[model samples]
Target: MRQPGRQTRRPERRIPQSAAELARVHERALAEAAARSAARDSAAPDDPPFLQPRPEIGDSWERLRRLGLDPDAGAAAVHLGPAEIEHRRRASGLDPLLPILRGTLVEQGEQPPLILAIADADGHILWQEGERGLRRSADRIGFFTGARWVEERVGTNGIAAALRAQRPMQVHSAEHYLRSHHSWTCVAAPVHDPGTGRLIGAINLSGPAHSVRPYLLQLTATAAKLAETELRARRLESLHHLRTLAAPMLARVNGPALVVDAAGWTAAAAGLPPPARLRLPAEGWGSTAVHWLPSLGECAIEPLADGWLVRPVRPQDAVPAVPGGSDGPGADTAGPGAGLLAEQAEGARLRLDLHRAGSPELSVRGAAGSWSHALSPRHAELLLLLATERNGLSAAQLADALFGDPARTVTVRAELSRLRRYLGGLLAHRPYRFAESVLVTVAGPEDPYDLLPTSSAPAVRRLRAGLVGGTVRLPGTPPLPGPRPRPGRLPLPPP
Candidate 1:
């Protein structure tokens, strides 16, 4: 109790200097925040600096609310199945760099360093290694290999911060927006494709809050750069190898000639203005095939040592007419325009109901009547992406949207091949688009947060954020059991 005329004093908030202290600070902050949220009336003052949210954390909090997430709730991180995890590791092209990163960490000592993790641009943790004890602790919070840590999924953290900032960042204690993550600290840096400068993934180090330091952030950033440099060097070496193999072939070809990897990356070119890029169909170049390229028109494709040799075909050349979904060379001339006409004549309709939280479906209607097609989660997202794009998307663009990295064109091609078997002629190539003649309609989510809740693709996440605004019902999750709250505040949804 204060004496007469004496003023009451508030205790000073302490800055955490150790892991235990950080945990204590988080508990205090949680209690204080809960008190503020529970107040019936009175305006809450700004949080003290030590407890105040960082700019990125503040933005992430708003995103979490818009995504219909409860501040009090915790959810396990999404992880890929074992098979899918292996596929992702190969597709990510980061396997080569993993050993280097691990070696650097191992040199730090036998005590074992903080968790060293690598996540694809979509924030999927492709590889995670470090101290075994800490790994077990992290598993409780879903920080294992294959787990996803995108901002929308996990709130503010070093990985998400690095991706957004396109640099290194350290997230410590209450600086993290999610209460569950307040006990740890993380530092991360974005990695990029050396050729295109596109974000590929991120390299991160995480552990107890006391382990965080300025130098760790710098070290992570340097490691990312080194890894990217290694990738660049490898790509250049491949191109050099391609040139050596193509010299004799280029000398023999009479017209425009170019060598491209399986995913259509240019290796060597001569006599042809290097066409932007050419993504071959799933059949690859083992057999003779025709690929309609962006700048080169229709071209006859042939396999090279480690790539393909493409020669633009003149209109006068009497090649077999391009056939729909055919493997023969004749299928080259069946252009997008003709494909669209065929689809229109058939009058196909595609209806997609993606509003259902975890379950999204697509149905196709033709002369024989409509039938629902079973869609794998990836294909479901692919169809949704194509449905949104009226003009269609190039292989690289689609890859970027689907995998959060454009280099995954190989994966995109394989998946689209399966989708083609399902849709048949309704799906057209050239740019991997829906046939213009098809009538496609999608039933969007009533609440933006519900929009593709299962999809963590970067493109989908961006669209979700763009569409979600103000307040929304908890559409991503099941409704609360009790009485409804006010318009803006929604109960936490189950994972």
Candidate 2:
């Protein structure tokens, strides 16, 4: 106990930076980044000021610029049309978290309201709600539902930063790369798929810069975690229900078999060790779907009470292994074995149409049937890059092609994961490429400029040059433009 008039010490917390302080620090950092750019003779005198940017921020800026964004004249908020927005909302699984997020951040009848916006993993804001007045203010900056807030499209903001970091983040005052956004502050966190651990989207809280406090970041982070917890709970409940249904079915089957839920988790298994996990299509196959599962070749699937019943088409293939290595039954399904089975499938064909307006389209012909899905912008670009490579590229090489940064393997991997889901066994890993037996064809406009207009990769540029110059020739198709190269140096034909 303190005695006399002496005051006792109290714990102190780090104070939130005032708007002016944030401006100063950010200005200095941006000036340093700008100075470095000037030293390299890559920056023009009239370039937009970049406040001191974090490394992630700097990388984002570089990618945006390479994508043809103009810092000085930033993009208008681009929103998906109504139908597309609806499609994303249904798929995002973020709807359940909205009430909790809103209740936490918004008061019953608060005077000045803070905006809560939720964006898909690609940074498209699907939902935004707040006070009437604040909503109007948000509208001016395209913070309304449907606006795209990706760093590449808009610049530094919490939604983009959080998505890139795969964690909660805050962007305040002049920390925003775009001058228009400096007057606002935002905190956001990425939401992930509980089963797949894939980023699904982000949730953000935004308001005037003065309203920001250091604790807001933590608040948003906690909210995000709570949301993830909810997802885990929901998944466990689903698995529980699946198990109850599967128990009855499992007892009836004698051969090695398993019952999997819609998302592909093993609900129950008998006479064999279960694989760690599996993935199901967004929609169920009418009565059944057949796939070449890893290690297990040509398995037949029939709709179960809750999920599906998986059994080997060949009775011999379903025999349980002796719980050990190569000599055992499950040996072939271990580790990279599934991929080996995929490689064995023959006569697979992949058709890509680059001439289609907006985004390119992909259709893969497999043993089941032809399945088609529209490619995202990044997917289209990656496929184009890989299509150009005679030998497949390593992850690092693909990263460099997609982002112009070899270090962005995680981002590359995520995009590839989405692509693989659409194509199934048609895609191969190790050095990522189309399957060996896949016959890939790219249909493009006669003019090279019309080919993959959204892609800025150096390889794409070279492809345009080759097509424009007639230096490249497609097998069984007319040659591209430009003067022919000498016989020995001619570009290799597409495989």
Candidate 3:
């Protein structure tokens, strides 16, 4: 807890002081006032104070002079009153707005088409996914940052309509209500959590009507897909994080979890009540929460919002013992020859499982808590052989220990080379060397790694629950039927 005035370690960044100029451009107060004055009404409608032109602009030079601004320095800034200063503090950019607007649409050397930028309701970039030059343009337009695309504020542009309609739409060229935007076309699509019907956001592809392609509509969908894909992947990562952290806790409490990702898929899961998977239908699991099965052992799950949770199962639920090392049939019968190789086989199993899902990672550590980044089964064997023997294994001795056949001489040497390079890379500070034809182990009193990286403390629990022994139930579409099952073979359509 922070004391009332104490600073937190997560320091806040300083707000930029250039916001005054940006406010003047985006709000267009001067232009509106000019139009109002021209309309024969001396009194203008109330305008946001910050939106009024800065007195420091070209015409305001003399006024700036009174404020002690040095014209020669190019460092003189807009002088604002207290209220104006506070309002500017809340404005978006530190850059001059006109230059930003021009930079967004116009080209400069090495600065391409993505000059312009635009943002959505949640202050996120939506149309910025277009060509780089246009993106640059939008950026200068104040469309990229602190933009709110919610319906009432911006009307039916791609971002606003998607949220309001809760469906995808394309607000192409000439469709814009704001006459100022008659030059550009936009295509946008809404992303949904199919299970919950919650609209995450929309992706929009926009560019100059003359330069952009009609098929940017397809590009819009593609961008939405990419976003959804990323959401799903992040879910999986969160699940893995939960799995590792929840291990110690899950042992203490019994509970099942359903891990959801931003894209509606249940990315990773563990301790799901058996009855839920077996008794309930397959389609039953996607979006909503169901009643808990106390028989599975009641456990409370804490949700780590970016889609991860770890909780205990019901206390009454029975959890079978986890296998010590062996799994799969044919567990015995390795004979005296393979008796020492069991851990190597177990390590191999783990490696294969990892590769099938994603990356391959295997670790073997001594009781002293030292880790060896063992890749091949042979590597595990050599490490184990080194640890067990009272007498060190020489080049010839290791060859005998690894493969009894002396003809396998060069083969053992190759495996040793691999192991040496791997461990050396991982523990670079404390070097491991391969000298002569022999393998040597270096003992250095160094502490192993203690913490794993994660976003924050709250997310740690859910991330750990994801990785270990969890099943992910992904959304699926029914397969197309084969030509209506050959009309005659299936009964003819009933009238």
Candidate 3 overall lDDT versus native: 0.34
Task: Arrange candidates, best lDDT first.
Answer: 2, 1, 3
Candidate 2 lDDT, 1-495, residue by residue in tens:
111101111212235456676676555544544565442245467965433444444444444544556555677658899999999998998888777777766654533458888999888899988778878988877778888997666777889877655557777777676767778988887777665455688889898887766667776777777787788788779888988888877898868788877656667888766764443332335554676453354578888876889876664442222233222211111322223236434686666777743346665555533444444446677787666554678888887665568998997886676455435466778888877787888777655554664344555655655665578654225664557665323343111
**Best candidate (score: lDDT):** 2
Q: What lDDT does model 1 reach?
A: 0.62
lDDT of model 1 at position 267: 72
| Per-residue accuracy of model 3 over 306-345 as CA lDDT, tens digit each | 5434344444442221123121111111101111122222
Q: What TM-score, computed on C-alpha atoms, does each candidate reach? A: 0.52, 0.56, 0.32
Clashes of each: 5, 11, 49
User: What's model 1's lDDT at 453?
Assistant: 51
Ranking by TM-score: 2, 1, 3
Point to the candidate with the largest TM-score.
Answer: 2
Task: Assess each prediction's global lDDT (C-alpha) against the native.
Answer: 0.62, 0.63, 0.34
Query: What is the C-alpha lDDT profile of model 1 across 376-423, one tens digit per residue?
Result: 456667887787665778889888886669998997887677466446
